[model samples]
Target: MPKQIKLNPLSIYIHIPFCVSKCAYCDFISHRVGDFEINGGVEAYFNSLKTEISLYSGLLEKSKVRSIYIGGGTPSSVDGKFIHNLIMQLKSLANFSDEIEITLEVNPGTLTEEKLNHYIASGINRISMGLQTTNDQLLHKIGRIHSTNDFMTSYEAIKRAGIENLSLDLMFGLPGQTIKDIENAIHLVGILKPKHVSAYSLKIEEGTPLSESYQKGSITLPDEQLERDMYHLLINGLAEKGIMQYELSNFSSASFESKHNLVYWENEAYLGLGVSAHSKLNNERFSNTSRIYDYSKLLSEGKLPIVEKEFIDTSEDLFESIMLGLRLNKGVSINKLNQKYNIDFNVKYANALENLLKQGLVILTEDILKLTIKGMDLSNQVFLQFMED
Candidate 1:
């Protein structure tokens, strides 16, 4: 019999779906409530997470965990004790790496000097803060609770705590926003000198309040050309400051790229825990129940979360590898493609791939395939054309 190929090592994502308040344009599975009710759910969720990790203990032993990220509703919303307890529990559940990148997603409003200090002591080396935009008017328009000044306070607190691996999130093309506003926002970001930056345009999801506003004609946003201009300007501005664009919206100084996020772009497997989180293990992808009550009820019965799962068919994995590989600026190796999947990216997607080349959307040289400036702009359409059939 042929030897079974071991899966690549896993990264872990733990979702803390509790927030102080939900933004009008936000679509993540985050909750908002009084402190007491939020506090009540922390322990139960962590226990459920521990139970989930226990099931993968064997895989954990076989693979060296790459990165561990705690995201969602602001993870910093929880008290220091919650963070401490959760970290301790994770430590006990798996053979986690000592040098692994442990990132904690925080909101500016929830972090204080003391809280940041405690978080650092608890083994969180990387911090991702959601700043959205520096314009107070735009911030308020989006129903974001944190003001620019609040972000400054929290940023300084993180600095004072000596945590340097930092990333800031920004949004563009919001309602009533202009190129001037984007310029101002970019300048404000320069003041912070964040090691990494991720600036995405506001996407109006169907169920979001902002989307409703758009549907009712209460607000109007920039057109595609303007949005593209904003992205180009953002890229140029960040590049002038020595930041390199690693993926579409993510930028970082040479040494500050998010290791945790890189796992996904590299097409590696990862385990996700908590309500609504998705996991990719042994070529199968699964998501937990989105409803908190359902998740808890199922956990109470000693059942592992398995709301939905699909084995990534061989062809789907091929398309996934291409889609993910193209997202990286470096692209993927042609030789490795043959060794792993037995098909080269250039060969498998040749027809549409040639059309892109003729249209100047893709470029190939030295055994690597990458997107051109025009390609990055139309990348979604390009990737969609090659998806699994």
Candidate 2:
């Protein structure tokens, strides 16, 4: 019998930083095929990832691994058996508690049926596939490899594999996008009936081709009013399908909420391995080096690639906890606040909270504090107060 492990978060994240191609809008540290110098680079990448994973055995001891999230530029770009071997190594090193969540981020066009079965048989129960939009023109404009039809086939295959939990990623406010486009996307979502959905607005980040186009004024985005209308319609339309918004971006049906993400927003501690992964261990924050060569070099030399670590200070701790806690629909617990922080959380941010409350953005009660409808709409404004530290 498999040994029983405790039911806390000893979660691990493995980064597979290779992709078939880079999307125009993505700036993640993922290398396309022609970028690698070494002949056996995929082997080197896997070995480097395992070397990093081994460094944590001493740190985690026998803690129960509640979840494992294998995210990337695109995890499916790698061989599924390599992932299976990595999962096997993980199983031997630390015990996975019953109900451990293992998730892989996939691109719809990249996976094959045989590999999909290997992923399921290898113990990946949850799959998060990137399906940015149903509109083919928008997809082409964004330089995504997959069309809407490709996502459908991939979705059908996951069902055929007998894997149950699935997540579909959606984005809005693309350059030259309309509210009608978003509405059409929602109708497509209803037909798909995915168990979970994550919706994000397109942001123009530096070092991305999309940002370059925006800087050149070669593309025009929907106006702010239109963007907000799109978001509102997105929430209401998904609600019609019984997928309730659990976090700002994630919506889920009963028991389908993302366990690994909750590890983040709830401020629970977890270990992150591989390049560019971040970790919060016992109120301390640490991030790995972003460059793959640098990460590989350091691990090959028996050194940690950790670039930064900060111990949580008092005011910083309170604000961080509150900032993270309010992202949930469940809200923040005022009693837990007084217990954990040794100060009234309300008064520390009382003025700011009250100002937001008056704006019909945040709601406060005797025991709980949560974002109101208006607050969810203006969540960035609410979260900005916590960024002062």
Candidate 3:
């Protein structure tokens, strides 16, 4: 009998870089919908995106796509038919897993019944909506286009449309945000009962409006201690609602975690299409050009619009696997790492492991290495210890 070979599973991420308006604290590669009208509009961008996906036809043949995520800048803002066509094209190009998980990111005040119908027809089993905060005043301060009522409307609409796996994105640490505000949001989560919730602290990136406001002392953000307190409250509150913590920033009901995101945290291979999207395939990592015009032009010319590429060596790959794996609650398996990297995990990081143990940051048991609750708070410092010196 001949030996059989198993193909590796792949995940796909498509970036839609158009939004109704940019948030005050957002630094992602996204532009206003009206601003790009002169540059051939969303239609042209979709065409370019289609071309980009077709470029990877050969790669698609060798791997089965297990998950597909259509993310920012508000994928739901654009016409849903484009998303449908994109998914249909992907289905034709590759061998989709029988239980493939397809997710689409949406925002409140942008979703309509017609759009929801189109998404349902497109095999979009999951929908992730951004409901940063329930406080209307805080929403305006952050430049969000929707209010709490808008979120409720959209939530009901998605549920009515029959999409069971829903995830909500929540933000904390905003200027003037209090623990009470997070509690309100958490209370809403309990009421709505989403399958997954991703709570993140706001990072004031330079060149953002929020950053400028802070620099001028016009806006005051929650101090570090307050921010930490808010995070702890969020964790405990969500857990009480049956949304247990799975990753550092992600909590979900049992069996309803974001599978697409898990692909990244596990250091698995995935393909990213569209402008500003990134990918990790085998040992190489690359990203598309962030400039919309440049991305469209390159794809139109039958060339990849990759602006950055890095071939991760063995040592770097090992470190990344450890860093990302620690983000999950189950942690990384030492036996799996040893088999994959062909190294004795204990012997390679004996000194760092000793220090981490002494500090009580991480625990290695039976062969699994996982972070303690405190380690999750200071994960950056813990990850720094494992870096190759």
Candidate 4:
């Protein structure tokens, strides 16, 4: 008998790049539905997505998919039937693990009970809802379409639908935001008791509406000290709610950590579909075309629609492993890294390790190297130490 090839576990991320309205701070590749609705609507995009999936069917057949994350400019903004059909199509093509986790990212004022029902029936076991802040004034200031009431209604509906795996996304460090606002948001988390919380500090990306306004001096964000204060408050507040810190900006209740996100942080291989999506498979990392027309045109020509690709050489791979692994609280197992890379971790990274240790950034307990709380705060600085200079 011929030797059997070992199959690897995979994760899938499907992007729904349609939004009801764009937020001021967002830099994600998403189009307003009104503009695209006239030009063949989302149906055209879904067709192209199916084509992309078909192109990867052989690869899918060789891997067992463990997680599927349907993210977008509010995936719930569109008709639920489209999402249901898409999930069914993927199921037909891939060998899904029996304990597969399917997550759908939603926005408030867009999700209805009927739409949520469709998602539940389609096997979406997890829902990540965006509730940037509870203040209505802040919602308007940030150009968000939903109010606190809208988020409350949508959140309650998800709970009533019996979908227990819920994750709430919150943002700090917005213009005109105060400590009181963050306190209120944290209090709401305690009251709501969500399974997971992702608290991120705002970064004003260049060319974004918020960034433009900031550049014009029309608005001013909280100072560096205030932002740091807000982050520490988040860490302390979530702990009081029994949501322990697992990653730098993520908190979860017990085993409720996001498996799909873990795949990325663990440097595992996964496939990303749809326009502007990125993927790391085998030894190469690649991304699809960001333009809708270009994506559809290439797919119609029976091509992969990939616009960029790069091979992750062993040196780059090791650095990535070290960088991503440190993002977790448990940190990386040096023994495993040594075995996989065939090197002594201490000897190979002695200089970097010495610097990190002296700076109180990282500590190695036995064979595991993990970041201290201070290191987590200054994670970018720590990652820089591991780079091949």
All models: lDDT?
A: 0.82, 0.85, 0.93, 0.92
Supply the TM-score for candidate 1. 0.94
Q: What would the per-residue lDDT of candidate 3 be over residues 66-126, giving only the tens digit for each residue? A: 9999998889878889999999999888888999999999999999888998999989999
lDDT of 4: 0.92
Candidate 2 global CA lDDT score? 0.85
| lDDT by residue (tens digit), candidate 2, 74-145 | 888877888898888888788787899999999987788878977987899999999888889999898898
Q: Rank the candidates by lDDT, best first.
A: 3, 4, 2, 1
TM-score of model 3 relative to the true fold?
0.97
The per-prediction CA RMSD against the true structure, in angstroms, equals 3.1, 2.4, 1.6, 1.5
Q: Pick out the ten consecutive residues of candidate 3 with the lowest summed lDDT.
A: 31-40
lDDT, residue 129, model 1: 92
Which is the better candidate, 1 or 4, if ranked by lDDT? 4
Q: Each candidate's TM vs. the true structure?
A: 0.94, 0.95, 0.97, 0.98
Q: Residue 365 of model 4: what lDDT? A: 82
lDDT of 3 at 73: 89
